[model samples]
Target: MPSTDRRHDIDALRALAFALLILYHVGMYYVAAWPWHLKSAHPASWLQWPMLALNIWRMDLVFLLSGVAFALLARRAPPLRLLGRRAWRLLVPLVFGMWVVVAWQAYAEAVTRGAVAPGPGAFVLRYWAMGPWPEGAFSGSAFGITWNHLWYLPYLFAYTAAMCLLLPLWRHPAGQRLRAACCALRGWWMLLLPALPLAAYGLLLAPRFPATHDLLHDGYLHPLYFTVFAYGFLLGTDAGAWAELMRLRRRALVLALVALAAYMAARSLAPDWSEARQALRALYAWSALAAILGFGHRWLNRPWPWLAWANESVYPWYVLHQTLIVATAFMLAPLHLGPAAEPLLLLAATLLGCWLLTDGLIRRVPWLRPLFGLKFRRPATATPAPVRPAAEPIPR
Candidate 1:
């Protein structure tokens, strides 16, 4: 059975995951041989190593946490009510984000690429009109619009709806038995069994679909993400599963590190070994996740002064971070600041923007709350009542 006690570790892990995402986007600007909306004048070849390490599993971790969050919320409300609330929370921001928050990113990309004339006013008019643009106008000009970094919102909302539709079966005795069997896995079984499906997906589906991130066409990612999401949901309240994670935390870390080293060596030394590399990548991804969960549960389960604030602020930070990075980079590129100073300035500007906009403007304005994935503040004049715990917001 699910515990009534709060999962502080899960909350902390989610916050940290989003924080890592912010850093990753900043790195994207400097990482060499990768396409980003904007790129630094002097790209660092070495940056790709760390970026690739993170790219393998960061979004997977986010989806897993989303499923864990959904499991918690599902325990508190009826399926229909939960589905309605999720749709409102997810879709509202997605619409608002694509139109308002994400517009700057698209405009910046088009302007940088010289695909469109450099005028914010004209671009906004054309963008909002949803008409075709010249080839190479922006990241998704072929589609007439782009969600950019906010793609996770619609994907998550879809998964939530699917799960809700299957709620009855999930609650059935057969489903419960299957979940229990998964949770009861221990030792090597815990590590190896979960990775088989991921490897299978990598071997079979990855080459065919190739991860467009455009909800409808992403065949490989849908199964991969949904599988991990289901893993999280199944393990959410399983004490035995968590205990096994904690017990294997050290070994998992070592395995993850070794796998990473082997994978990188293979990529550099024997690029033709596609099947072996794929299997190793899957192994490393799962091991890294297991190690992270184990360490987080061991050390982060207690409430800290910052936890409450982070839980509230992470969603807004996520929605705002990528645009800030792209915009800051766009503005800074012409200055000829040295590589070190330029990226540092960009990072500083992005963090300051997220903090200022999220705290000073978004949180303070009641009407602006829902658009950024926050609940409205209670009116000061209302009668006092016990505070109910808010459902966890899905991380972007």
Candidate 2:
């Protein structure tokens, strides 16, 4: 759906945001007071501050970018066909990952926690057979299967399908007015407009239904993610919206810094949720998103060779990264490597494994490609040195 004119900025942002996820997940292995598949022996309380900064808007940015991709695809295919392509591209990976790839993460968690007696080799068979293991340490513990970190695909696909169902309304009068309003947002309004839906969700639904990421019952996340996805669709399709973001980019950054600072200060006073805290939380979340979008549009628009490959590889990397993190950490944690060496080794192992597995194997091999959400055919070469052709099929 990315036109002949590529938005390398989106590609850059997507790549960078995901890169941030890798670092943050590494932090998750060590961040204090957080429950995860595996935890470091020495958890650092200080990590909470920086982790919160990235945590609020990282996934939202991905959802927003996905909506942008959807808008581009909407121009090329009918809603039904687009939905079909997304299912083929996304659902296959989600299902394949759940059945085959993600099982390792679950096994690592259960074994690390002493919830399961056996090693991953034996547990994989039991897991494949749908036996719920003991202590329920893995994600989706009650069920025999779990997507683990790959929960985004199902949620994104459902949102895309829902948007397709409403395709007719996208160009209707009210929808046009809505788009116009978004494109017209300027200065402070541009900075704050997208936050309203998210704010409403945070204030209302988030308390009642906490984020389980289970896909079926996460009420709070639906409204917020769907709204951001819709925001991406509308704004990405509107040229004026790009111009507006450019104009407000600096302002958005300033607002983001101030809001984040205030959010931090409020955390010091009373970290628990209240109506005022919810509103501030929403404001902080949305501002961070705006800053990223505005900055990406302003500075990241130019085409670059590495970025094109990074863009195409984003989905596969997302599918593969966290599992590698958990597995790598699990293996290294026993070495008494200390905080410094353990994380360093874990990150190195994760990166090496992902590169070898994703680029060396998955990208080149035809049959295994679609299983990880990659196009079946690619230049047999490593990411093409020349950028333009590579950028065409996959939108930045």
- Per-candidate Cα lDDT values, in order, are 0.91, 0.84
Candidate 1 lDDT over residue span 1-396, tens digit each: 224478999999999999999999999999999998998998999999999999999999999999888998889899999999999889988999999988899999999998888899989889999857989888888887889999999999988998998878989999899888999999988877898999999999998998888999999999999988888888787878898898899988999999999999999999999998999999999999999998988888888689999999999999999999999999999898998899889999999999999989999888899999999885467678766568856458
Screening candidate 1 with a backbone cut-off below 3 angstroms (N, C-alpha, C), the clashing residue pairs are none
TM of each candidate vs. truth? 0.95, 0.92
Model 1 worst lDDT run, 10 consecutive residues:
386-395
Candidate 2 residue 28 C-alpha distance from true site, Å? 0.5
Lowest lDDT 10-residue stretch of candidate 2: 378-387
Best by lDDT: 1
The sequence of per-residue lDDT tens digits that candidate 2 reaches over residues 101-129 is 89888888888778887666789988888
